[model samples]
Target: MDRRLRSILKELIQAKKALTSKFIANINQVTPRTTQEDIKKLNQQLLSHGASIQSIKGRGYHLHIEDEQLFRHFLTTALYENKDQKQIPNTPDQRVRYIIQKLLLTMDYLKLEDLADEMYISKATIQNDMKLVREHLSNFYLDIRVKPNYGIRIIGEEMKIRFCMAEYLIQRGSDSNGNIYDGFIRLPKEQTDFIKQTIIAHLEKQHMTLSDIAIQNLFIHIAIAVLRIQNGHPVDNDANPKQEITHTKEYKVAEKIVGDTEQELGVIFPPTETSYVALHLLGTKILTTADIEKNQDIESLLDPAIYELVIAILDRIELEMHLNIRHDRDLMINLGLHLKPAMNRYKYGMNIRNPMLESIKKNYQLAFQAAVHAGVVIEKYTEVTIDENEIAYLALHIGAAMERQKLKQGPKRCLIVCASGMGTSQLIYYRLKTKFNGKMDIAGTTEYYRLSTYPLDDIDFIITTIPIHEDLGIPVVEVNAIISKDDLQHISSYIAGTPSNVIRDFLQEDYLFLNQSFHAKEDVLAFMVSEIESDDLKRARFLESIYEREKIAPTAFGNLVAIPHPLTPQSQQTFISIATLTEPIPWTTERTVQFVLLLSVKKNSVEDLQPLYEMISKLIEHPESLQKLMQMTDKASFMSMMETLERL
Candidate 1:
């Protein structure tokens, strides 16, 4: 196939969508009939190469690559090498032959005309090209067959195919074992014998202690270091040559990677020695007329310690599990693309769906909005498939924002009141601080009876463990000592905001009750039960019983947050109740609970609990939203407020 035509087909494959006949027409706009003929020819060629072309009756053609995994296997072994290879100098015909060989390794069949166009030659020229490919590659018994009207095909022994590939890669200046030691001279006879003896002794117990290629690369490195020292360069203590070395950015990258590798592997690799070897192989004097860094910058970053550690790890895996992790970029990238999220969750000590996930969630709706506003239309090449994971991510973000708004509503100064002097008072103080953190300036702890007598000049809010009878000229939030981290975070969120002093305005001395409703459940609970199913509520109530027992330790996990959860499953239904206090009350000594969510879980289903927790955690974040919610009198209004909060 011609080089130009091959490039065109490859581009189409990457496009990921169907091509219109018009699109193909545009590609060969100058000569429509000729291009049509070319397309037919390319299709035939593809079939011969163990691949096929899918042509929509009305639409255009698409390449259907077969045996993709086999193709990758072939490419890895055939086109690439584990180490460096010499750059082959040859004629253009040789280069063309090399290109054809490498392309075949892709295992993607191409049309003859397309191949001809890629090579920028005529059909006759392609025929000649094929003759040369056959003449040289004949010993490998690789057949390059042309099916005139169909296309062309190359067939042969898979092993020989790989050998041809290795040859092509070496000729193309690829790093392979064959030429790894090209520039390095042999060590002194005694030194050489000693090195071999040492390697043999080390490998006696393991037949594959080191690959033939690895040993050769190691020798090259050592030999290059020796040559640099012998050539009158300043010799370091380690017998490495040191010249007028300047640390460029690339070298800095090398230094950083080397340091990381050394720490991880626990071995010291002298920079001077590595630098000499690198310079000998890739330096300006050896391979090029002018000095320039090439592809091997990454290779130079390999410290001996890290390299050896990697080898050792690979060796163990092969021995113990019989699993080989290909060190190639494509394989590693594919693996990493899958493993990164798992690793991130593990390191951060977060659940799969973390409450804080909202902060980092991608707002696709917002993105679409922006795109439309900017008059930009997305030209999707592939089918627009919905990603469930992405939806979950967005949901997490929304949940986090809801939780944040709850924390943003509290005032700076708050006074903690309780019947007990320092014991309960101190617990209240600590809990408030845990929730509000830098946001709250706790006035002090005092008895509720002291409120009228005590100066209330700077107290923005008052929190009490026990209910008070007299109007204290401040908003008083009564709470139980045992509170969850979720509730505390919600309360801290409210205390952080500058909501109106409803305590001073709404509380009447006559309305004050010592044992006034500590928890207002009539309306809010009704609202939850109305919105959520009966089963959900029952599950939530069951979960709450477990939480009651586990109240032995407060769930105040700092950041002005508390997670009120049942320790075990006992409920038939689950519902979350969110409460934001005007002032944060003492839930416990370890944390405070101003915002309380009673989780009633049913069926002990982890799946059901995930969504409930996700939603509650997200909702507790908004201070203004919670305050608005608290002020709502009707169910409809509250639901509307929730909807608005969800929009946020």
Candidate 2:
């Protein structure tokens, strides 16, 4: 099968629900008609395998498996066949990446004609690909220049060239079983193994717990450094001469690791090389609970400024996102510990490569956004711009805390007040218990007459069979004596509370701006701010805060969505003003945002906005809904669709 077919199959396999033709087309950057044809051809190929694509009229296409073993075998064989059958680049983007990788791997000048011949493309096509190659290399601060007699060569600082090689030259290796191999540099397997084992032994001795991906990243860095040094390209000593790094314990550890490798591999590394490895150690070490000594104060162990900064970040996150993770002491310590070395990296302009950045962004978007907020705080204090990779690492710390909070929250406690006799109440109780399972904790049952004498102090809400018109301090959900699916849904609605309720309450018709023609993010923000009925000073401050947040990181969350908000609350009342552009506007280099949700919280407000943010995140996840919202010409249709979507 072709690359596009494989891409479609992968998308179908990974999708949680059936993927629409439009969604698949968007992903493949093609028209729906073209995608449909591709799907038809893919289905033809799958007939020999054990899977087929089922098209649902007016819905989408779903992948059906007839035999799992056969399907798995087919996938393996197909992948192996593709691997063995090396072919030239067939697309412009692929050709660009190919040229970039080729140029980065070789030190000598590469002839344009040679590249054209290798890819079986014309010289003009090769020239166009080189233009893209230069554009991509510019991001790494590398330049591609052509000599009069010689061909094109990549010229840059040695360290930058190494960084580019680390990013582009080596292939992201994987095994036959689809396992990713860490040895990417062109070193012998035994040598790579020796370096990895050396680092592992020393890390174990120091009781440091770096993640697998972190270990692999460190291994790759050291391997590349060794290869580059052997080729007479040592890192410049004057790049960053922070004497404090030499005094740190990680520096000593790095020295020992490099010393052992140098003896084994017969290559000598300078003091700067040791410091470079130590910087990696400092940035990637995962803090275990054992790191904190018993009865030792965390604040005393961490830098005072970082500790305070972490606290401030948590406070701001709680105030804005209302994640309820401010009291997570473990999170505070982790963030503080991470910030110490991260601050060092930022101070010296060191880059820490995060291999799991893409996965983290896709899987933990809400947490990533919260981390972006944290990054803003870091930028304010450190006066350094934090990249997405660093922001993603911070997100991991915050995501873990959010997960811990979920595991610690137990379940919702509710009391069942059935008007029927004990027998019927018992039936209802068993049904709810079986349905909700671990999601709910039953606080026992009681009859309506006995409810007045029952203790309601420990209950979060009351589930009753019949309506009781009495004032209670908790929410009461009414259902039938025998719980039906609709009754359970009603209880669920009461329990989770459809985010549409919050959206409807906060998103007023006057505040909603649909199909607005704005070319830039600033224009969109200014228009949205003007629409808000607030004082001039507060409006100006709010606009300034939006720009300040943008400087730290753009608010574009991808999927054609951008949620722009101030760093802090700037209004007397919290509200969300939404503006959907007629055409997608550039919010960032990688993201063109069509839907902009401008959020402003009430000043000094303690209200929980988690549901509001959750709703926005949910909307971001559904591209179909975004497309539908963008197509809506009137507010009524948009509101109706939003309400329907919230229930789904």
Candidate 3:
């Protein structure tokens, strides 16, 4: 099959929903007729392989497989048939990544028409891609330099080029184990393995060892250096080589490794390249508690400044979120060790890829938020904007600490709430205490008026008979004052953090805007922000905060959904203002969003918002859910749909 037909077939096979011809054409940059013809041709080829394309009347094209085993065998064969060849990217997303990597690797200028010819695409399609290309490059202060007849090449600081290369060339081609494979590089495995073994042997000889990931990173940089130097693109000698690093153990090891590799690969090692290798060693030098055994604690092992930065970050998180993990020694040790190298990355402008970023965001929402605040504090120390990838790495450490905190917490601690604990609230409190004595910790009873000022630092939730108008930085379960059987069961479910009862707390009808028309992300954000701050004054300059987070990283997490919010909490009460656009609006360079979920959380709220974020993450991963959500026209149906989201 041809590239275009194979592309369409792959889309249909991988699609969770039927693939629309228009959507297929938009990605391939072809006419609807061309897409239809391609699908028809693909179907003809798949018939003998036990699959066919079934086009529905009003919906779209779906793939029907007659024999799953046979079809899958064929797919596996086809998938690996071109393993040894360079793949011409089939879809827009693939093409953009390919273009970026190709340009980053190419030291010479590339003509648009030549690239178009190589990818089997029109010049117009590739040109349209360049707009996004330029936007991505601008983040790293890199841009395309086009000469009249010489064509275009990426032009920027050489260091920026290397940073971009580390991401696109090295990081992008990694496998599930975080191993850098030979996807874009032409170097053979024998040569790459030699480089890896050389570094490991030298490091081991020096009584220093790096993790598998760090070793893999070193191999990629060294491999790329060989290729680039062979192509006359050596690291510019003056690009900030530290003399201080030259005296360190990492430098001596790097120097010996370079000497051995020069003999094996038949290439001379430059002094600048040796320093570059040493710099990477310093940036990736992770020390665990096991590595620092002289003292039982690791505070003495880490740099004082980096250790202090970790304390500053923990102090800020405790002050804002009040999770009381500021004194977590494991968390402090890990974060301090991480920041020492992390600051090295920032000082030298290095980019490290976290393969588990999306999973970290989805599974650890609260921890991710805490890490974002930690990144804010890091900015004060490093004077450089922290990247989302870095924040996600920090989230892993914070999430582990949070789990440790959870294990120590026995029963859910909460308050018995009603009109007043002095009145019927006392009766409800006594009833709750008698009904569930050991399963829950009834700290005391609280009144609705005093809920805001009440110290809810370690409180798990509140059992209230009457409704609480605002979020009191704690979860509230609205049970009957008399405390019936069903109410007790509901409270138990909430104590378990099931959240089937608390989801409605976020889906207020006043904040729901359905089927709105928005042509751009700014319009969608402005509409949601205006509705959120209509009567509420706590979220002043809310839009700027949202943009501040976006400037760090775009929140459009694909699959037609976007969850945007301030980097830090802007409201005293946690709430959500949602908007469903009439059509998909361009939200980020790579994604268009039809569902906008503006999430705001109280700074010190102990409520588990994971279920809410899980529902949104489900929307991002499952296209059918987003389509159903975008088709809804009223708040009732929307809430009804959300009610069934936890099961997803």
**Considering every candidate listed, which one attains the maximal TM-score?**
3
lDDT of 2 by residue, 463-568 (tens): 8989888867566778898788988887776555443266676888899999999999989899899878766337788899988777665677766788888877
Across 428-529, the per-residue lDDT of candidate 3 in tens digits comes to 877878877887998888777777778888887878878876756556778777778999888777766677544577768888999999799998888787
* Residue 256 in model 3: lDDT: 92
Error of 1 at 297 (Å): 38
Could you tell me every candidate's TM-score relative to the true structure? 0.20, 0.74, 0.87
Stretches of model 3 off by over 4 angstroms after superposition: 1-42, 51-65, 79-81, 84-92, 120-125, 171-184, 283-298, 415-438, 443-459, 466-473, 481-485, 538-540
Model 1: how far residue 288 lies from native, Å: 35
Candidate 1 off by > 4 Å = 1-563, 585-593, 604-618, 630-648
Model 2 poorest 10 in a row by lDDT: 175-184
- Candidate 1 residue-wise lDDT, 115-220, digit = tens: 6666566788667666666665664557766666766666664434443443343222212322322211223455444433443343343322333433443344
Q: Evaluate all candidate structures by whole-model CA lDDT and list the values in order.
A: 0.42, 0.77, 0.77
Ranking by lDDT: 2, 3, 1
Displacement of residue 188 (Cα, Å) in model 2 is 3.7
The root-mean-square deviation over C-alpha atoms between each candidate and the true structure, in angstroms, is 26.7, 6.8, 3.8
